[model samples]
Target: MKLISQPGPKTDFSMLLLFTIVVLTMPIWLAPIGAGYPDLVQKFAIYGLFATGFNILFGLTGYLSFGHAAFLGVGSYTAVWSFKLLGMNPVPAVLLAIVTSAIFALLIGYISLRRTGIYFSILTLAFAQMCYQLAYSVLTPITNGETGLRVLQSDPRILDGVITSQTEDGGPLITNFFGIDMTKTWETNIFGIDVQLNAGFYFCAFFLILGSYIAMRIFRSPFGMMLRGVKTNQNRMNYTGVNTRPYTLAAFVISGAYAGLAGALLCVTDPLAGAERMFWTASGEVVLMVILGGAGTLMGPMLGAGIIKYFENILSAFNKSTLEGMLGFLPENMLDGTISVLSLFVGEGWHLTLGLLFMVVVIFLPGGLVEGAKSILLKLTGGGSKKSASAQAAE
Candidate 1:
């Protein structure tokens, strides 16, 4: 397996530029597009973090954990409880979420790692389901059942440094900045559009960039190579005097922490911790993101997360009226049926689109979009050097 190396100056420089552009200007692009803009991007960032962390276990360590939602739920609950009891100081809540998630992972991993493959997966899934039941019934007072948790004015905002509320006029009563109120709308001109830029979005974007950077580094490290080795051959690794158990456990814990961080970030945006996020489907969806993007690739999971979340939020928003507007250019006889056909794969039934994508990807392109991109790059570069071909053949 390969280890992390310096991304060449050009690649590193390009990544820096890309980060600056996206993190700085996403608000501008998302604002005019509709309210879905900020929230959609936020979902991508958070889920990307979640998927990247999951990849550390499933992609690198070859451990399929189906109960990861337990950590996400744990994180979400921890953060929400922090807001409820401690205060709305986001930093503590985020940190507590990470720590709480880690503890859960450590405990769960210790037991689940005893078995490998399907048994391990089933164990994790059972444990997660156990947590779900506990939250639903046993932990009613803490989890607050189906209603979840929400912010209230009566709640203390200690460490909030500065807090603001929506005004009667429908504008922010106090502008969001570094604990400072601008008392003015937060925006600047962008391409003749009044972009509603705000500090909160930028703050979350910063975590997105940080999370991406961290994942990139992990993908390139010696520990990463060892994890990959475990994925490839746990038995072989053990015989070679390299213990795979701790490595696998570490990967699981780290992934759980990432999910926790994402859960906390989600709360920061909406300030609500919904129990529904703990559902197993949410865990499976993140796994889909990793598989779609190309497991074991740095950018693949993030790209996958973005694509799936985009479809969920943006594509699913399409309705009959919107379809009719576009189809107005077509002949009336052709319009209705065509729109109906398209609707089966999108809008309210968008999961059908996702399922199909997953099927096609698994059957035809097992390595996923990143692998597909690599194949194209290889073809463009003329089938690699003779020495490289020989080396690959040897492998």
Candidate 2:
């Protein structure tokens, strides 16, 4: 009976600005505290983009797609193709990838949109599985089969005037961008800590910032409101003479483009596109990210992506030495067999921790980490006065 007004441009932009400061400065702040934990920086950057785009679709339109990794794989393969057939300018590669993903989303959306709810999810899942299998078999020449598509010493450098990849020295291959070699690292002091920065991290960070900004803008747009309406009540939206197909299709395409951008960033950072990325599980993980961070919240999915990626990269990186160090406070004699027992749960089996976290989030914080944060803030800040009583569903 009552509609809550969305934030004005001023409030929306203020929120966006706050998020921008946190994202851009987080690496700098956490760099020293985390002991050079930049390895996951690009992963967060790419997956954050993926989850943000996903929010546009699942978060806004309430379409729970289980096969979104198809778009990511398509974008990555497209980028790798650009590197192989076109050039390494990055612009063309990225554009081609986005377009490829858009086309795929259009096709999938046209077909899948015909169904609703579980049917839609299943349709998308089937398409994604088909893509995974095709990449593994039907497109061996392009996809390179199970081994995955990768840069090779003999692969043609179409963008380069020369025929091969070169090195710093003229005698060897050159893997570079413009005149700048990408294989080098830049060491800088930040907060009295040595930071070994690299071009790839910066490149991915640019896209992450750009993607987050765009998502924030979309969240504030009138069209975004319509999508949220569609999400809240599609049947009513249709009864109100609104064409839900076009809106849902648009959401799908935009989300697809986001996934594509993330994929291009992935290839740019690693210079490879693997079939494993297309796995159905990969698609499911993005869904987990959105849920983990609280769907329909601007910063939630990014936070969710950061949490999972941190666990995957950082927690998974821990091994015997880490366990021993952690248990060192105890007597050395008591520390024996502790790491081996711990190894069963972590180290290589770190996904167990992720699963437990997801379960906890679902059970205790049904709205996910963002809801948990709000509740904690409500308790800690002695209740936030600026906070809205109504939950803001990010479009």
Candidate 3:
């Protein structure tokens, strides 16, 4: 028997350096891109982590679980409960979120992994819908129904010994890291552009980088190779006496832990947990993020998350006036006609635009944005080296 040692830190310096630069300079680059707002920035980090985790199972193991959001919702519910009954600091809340979500994932994974293919996907989806229905109805006692669970001013924090959630100024106390309030934001004008940097965004960014690093390690590990084998040919692995179910289940639980952490971060940012977060559509959004950004690639999830969120937040916010200002250089008649047609794809019709974009990516760039970009770059550089390089890298 041979033991496989985990790779050393030095093996991943490039990955660490890349993410470090990106995370630290977000306030600089993200502002120009219309996603620098603290709230949106936090979403990018949270959903990026969520998609990255999902890729671990779906990308590597080829086992798509639509119930992953169930774990995320469970994490949010647990975190809020921790804050409500335990303490105001986010540490315990986040820890409890991970633990509870992991347990939930374990149970769901156990049942769903009993089958494969579309059957597996259906089982996961059914489990997620059941969880959502229960949370919205039967579990309303704990989940707080459709109104969502939130931090209240009168709840007792038995662990922290603080009786009320009010400050001397009479506003409700916000979630914090020790003494630093997670909601605190630092605003400044940089090169004539406004940048809103929040403590909570940085906190989420830290976890995103940490999660990405962990994922990169997994991608380069023997366990990840086995999972890939399961994806590529599970029958061959089974013929060789490999218990692929355990491998897939481990991947599923690991991904759920990541989703749980992401969910906890969401609550840490806003101190609220809604049953809507567990809906199957939320799971589908992460799936689209993973697919749009390049599932198997390390940076794909982040890119996909940013792009999808950009469309959802920034593009959807554009009104007729904003559109007119941007296209004012055109003839008034032409502009009116263009806006009339474009109006259906922005704002209230943003889903149409999103659907179009998804279709474009799926049809023309099946490997997602990363692979498409790689192909374009390779073409500019000239030749067959791109295919050979990608094939070699995959191997």
For candidate 2, give the lDDT of residue 175: 38
> Any idea what lDDT model 1 has?
0.77
In candidate 3, position 258 carries an lDDT of: 93
lDDT of 1 by residue, 1-395 (tens): 22224577589658867866876676676666553345566676778788888888888887888988888888888887777665555677788999999999999999999999899999999999888888877888888888887755555545444343323343322323345332223656778876765455566667778777776677778888889899888789999889888998899999999989888877765567767788888878888999999988777888898789888887798888877876789998999899989878778888888889889988887888888777668668876564366657679
TM-score of 1: 0.87
Point to the candidate with the largest lDDT. Answer: 3
Clashing pairs in 3: none
Tens digits of per-residue lDDT for model 3 on 1-395?
Answer: 12234457685786689788888678768899788889888888999999999999999999988888998999899989998888778889888898988888989999999999999999999999999999998999999999999877677756654533435455876887777789999988989999888999888898899899899989998899999899999999999789999999999999999999999999987889999999999989999999999978878988999888989999899888888988989997799999888888889888899899889999999989997897778667875565667667778
Model with the higher TM-score, candidate 1 or 3:
3
Off by over 4 Å in 2: 1-7, 33-38, 152-158, 162-175, 331-343, 381-395
**TM-scores for the candidates:** 0.87, 0.88, 0.92
C-alpha RMSD for every candidate: 4.0, 4.0, 4.1
Worst 10 contiguous positions by lDDT, candidate 1: 166-175
Q: CA lDDT, every prediction?
A: 0.77, 0.81, 0.87
For candidate 3, what is the total of clashing residue pairs?
A: 0
